[model samples]
Target: MTDVSVYTDPQAAVPTAPLIETRKLTRHFRVGRGLSPKMLHAVDDVDITIDRQEIVALAGESGSGKSTIARLLAGVYTPTSGEIYFQGRAVSSMRSRRDQLAYRGDVPMVFQDPFSSLNPAFRVSHGILRSLKLHQPELTRTQRNEEAERVIEAVGLAPASDLMYRYPYELSGGQRQRIGFAQALAHKPKLILADEPVSMLDVSIRIGLLNLMAELRRSAGVSFLYITHDIASARYVADRLLIMYAGHIVESGPTEAVLANPKHPYTDLLLGAVPDPRAPLSVAVEGDTGEPPKVIDPTPGCRFRWRCPLVVDECHHVTPTLRLLGDGHEAACHVAEPDAGMHATKP
Candidate 1:
């Protein structure tokens, strides 16, 4: 596992306060607008922390409320309950437009679809210039252009001045995605909420972007909340891995430890689901094919109980909170031992 302890070091010069944190962070949507409206619990009571320059991957299935958490942190969606803290300051306290703009500058969001995120009508420079103008008003037009060129080049886009003049339609998917990163960089952000940033790119190109993220963290001291469903990619770039399911963070720990010895039944199932390329082409893969449940206005029991192969009697009645198993690894499961999934059997 390459001694993941270095990444988990408690003496890594972490700030007195986390760069970003969510305390019991939750968000619910009103699905039905009729006389009897029902709340769709998209995200429920998730607590996470991102230290300066740390890469934390939030991995799960597609509808696992991963993007909702990103949106909440990006200020695109208001949290239904709970609070978000940036640099130890409550996000709710930033009520004024100036405060909100400042916060957004410090924490920008790079979305999933590179094509849709940028304006087709405008050149690649539009988004970057807009961000710089809003975040760095002191910069003149010429300085903004220079800064934009520097950012474009920084993201590995060659001939930055030439590329900046081209429209979004002129660029490849990877190039457009680099532009997205450049846009975020224009704000000089401290952290970025990256929602499936590399999922849309070619398998070959994905590594480049992941490497870029690591480089950004190494050089610029930028932090990231990397949201994705690909466990392999998460394992590759993230120092910490957080497994989310049914609006709950089911498992979290240092990436290698959690993946090497997953404690929760759900986490075990998730790892089992990852396709093994080394296996024989003729060999059939086996595991439960059940899908994650859609959480609505619900009861108190564990949400994963229905899909869990190792569901216990306690899981049917009591919602399990994250308990420290050992070495900072935690899971929300009633029947799982600290070392339960080290040699987990396929269900």
Candidate 2:
């Protein structure tokens, strides 16, 4: 078995090195059937890091390239440019089959769709047991079944024997989702890239899954890159937050701090849309007015400029770089003041 030293101690002092880091990671797809094909900037020059035992929530609306980032991290889609590093080792440079397999074993993904992620032909235990076979080939059949049952119970599926034989079709949406968590847990991975794992489940069940993930992080010393559009849930579970818009991370900071005082206009707009019980019923909701800009052949400026209420001439000319606003807080907006105040600008 590969020694996963990175996830050894949960209570130990935080390590300076990042477990997973991406430097200017970008992925582009060529579309249109012509000599001059357009380029879709699915992920554009984004930098992110996930430290050991940390839950970083990547929140963005649909088509904001959140899932693409998750896929890139999971080694599903190769990046067109830039780099991904796992435990300080460059992922692109891992040539040996052993090293590649070790990396995959250490970085399992919990996909969004519980219904389709598992095959209908096989029982729940078969899926997890198959993973155990590949990762732990030395284990005997009895040991493997015991480990499978333990993992199924760990994911909150009680009476593991009953669930072990059931097909994907027989389980409820929540049960299938728990089985998804169990499959990822079976690998004993250091990092889990959960891409909207609870969006399809009932609202009541979402908290249960999130709690299970938190428990895994605490007990097993696992790191998570949680991708979702739901800000409320993100705030509840994440320690830090990254708000993405039009393929760019516009704002990032401590979850509570960012929620209480957002620096970027886009972030403010998102917070405004969230229902507040204290606010009057007649309170007008401010939202993004226009459609998102075309990622294909994108203009050389801030992507949110077209829909921004505080648009200015400078926004149309120069792309705003992500700059530090305060302690650990960053924003990529020209008019965002350091203290979360809006800078007046000409339209």
Candidate 3:
């Protein structure tokens, strides 16, 4: 039961097409004090396709490598091995820094921390002007300023003129986030990678920001790759949701379908862990945070076996593949048949 409801837009005018694709992508890092340090398989083998004008959320617990995947797709880090394709052509094959720059203008990222990305010393106008000059330098001084102010207003930084000289510290969290968004949208980028864009904002402001993003998608056809740890919020904003665990997508498909009829044990645990108003403090997640499992050089079986309650001896011997079960829904589990019944009751 692939929940395709969140993605089906009757208003979209163009035939659906994939804008970005990654094949067998992988990234590994070596971390530790010893000269011969332990390797961290931050991003294991992953294949993904993002369609034009569609927002697909990458949701998982922190450190599941969702951020790594975001960085990889945005060209921030080249994949250790595998191919990255944008609009059918390969990224690594592209020659010349100018061509790369052109491609980047079409694909920009909005970071999680507004402070980390925005300089504290510069005024809001100065920040936007710098990006405009870098990406659209042909504009005259007046043209660039006008364009900057127009975009500022478009992203809902009200009294856009009034905020022109304000520094990062002068603005509220929500207002600062709006500026980051305005800068990203200034390029008129076709694809936007938002890494937890709303996590730092207040809950009320989060909805307003989300509503703005939704409007942008429908009006401008800007596809979003939203990375976040909030499942319910993902359901609200994403057309499709990819659930990642231990650097692997254990389950993925439409948000409603995957959330309602979760097939993987990890998915169930994740949803159960969501903060529910009905349960309040009783909604627990994995007992305690404790130390996460060390998956580098892990055995070939289920990486989640350390936490999966339904795990059996066979689960530790053979790794599960991301097999398509029905419709568009897919899962990497031994018992993921579409018609199979739930193995046990809720925790």
Candidate 4:
């Protein structure tokens, strides 16, 4: 089942301010065996907003462009087209050294693998202190040491004194993640673009880190743009959810609402397919069961049409722009179930 058009009384505009906004944000890469390679649309005309102190989960499987968006937001890969604004300031035109440094300082990224992210040769203290030295270089040596101790302890690295001497290999995966958090929190970033931050950790420890993140959000006002394919994790930490498919966002809204009633066919497939003990698991939606198509100057239409179970003829001929429903909810699907509540609204 598919659904669209999610407004009954059509609510008012949200009062909150968007911490980050990307208008027609796009990224393309040349990939081919020959010169003049064909462009692969890593991310296409995607528009989404993140609010201050809110966790926006960008959920999707691999090649779904979720991680690409996270990397783009983190200032790793420059966008081939479009602009990103942080607190109403445009980042595209600003290339000054000061601007770049400030951008990196304010927005830090946490990768999936904590072990690789940290230097194997250096002590755990070295990995966390490097960020402080670069960003807060004005601090005295004594002050920097104090800062490291403070952040590590705050991250619940109890007896933080003992952990500093350990190397990456010495610490457990959960401890490594805490050190990563310590690094990010040292700067007190406005936004942390976490690309599957806890995907590699043992299931038992994943919840602990997620809980720490949630507590950080509540206490420190740190906004998170967490990227993951796990809906259960998304439900655990996210206030909002953005479901992406084939370099495009199909639907997004308040987490509980979108999870309870996913609007797009792809989202429905995602929701129904997730492991749920509360509801009986159903057969996964089947169509063209594989990756997305070639994206060089792609023909204008819904990109999910190929695999979408309810894809209609209109989907191929017309590109559906995301339409706002109410209270920060939006989707870009063409054919939604008539009982939109079952697919787009909260229970």
Error of 4 at 276 (Å): 3.3
- Which pairs of residues have clashing backbones in candidate 4? 2-336, 2-337, 3-336, 3-337, 4-336, 261-343
lDDT of 4 by residue, 1-347 (tens): 01111111112123344778898999998877776668788899888798777899999878889989988988889999898987777887668987777778778988899879999989989966888888888998888888788778877787777887788899999999988988887776778888898999999999998988887777667889999999999999999999988788888899988877667767776775665566545644333353465467678888877766666799888988777665567788777643374332221
lDDT of residue 173 for candidate 2: 89
lDDT of each: 0.87, 0.85, 0.80, 0.79
TM of each candidate vs. truth:
0.93, 0.93, 0.90, 0.88
Evaluation by TM-score, superior candidate among 3 and 4: 3
- Which residue segments of model 1 deviate by more than 4 Å? 1-15, 289-291, 340-347
The worst-scoring run of ten residues by lDDT in candidate 4 lies at 1-10
Q: Over the full model, what C-alpha lDDT does candidate 2 score relative to the true structure?
A: 0.85
Ranking under TM-score, best-scoring first? 1, 2, 3, 4
Model 3 / residue 260 / CA error / Å: 0.8
What TM-score does prediction 2 earn? 0.93
RMSD of each: 4.8, 3.8, 5.4, 8.0
User: Per lDDT, what order, best first?
Assistant: 1, 2, 3, 4
lDDT of 2 by residue, 146-231 (tens): 88988888778878888999899999988998888788888888899999999999999999999888888887778899999899
Better-scoring candidate (TM-score), 1 or 3: 1
Best candidate according to lDDT: 1
Best candidate, TM-score-wise? 1
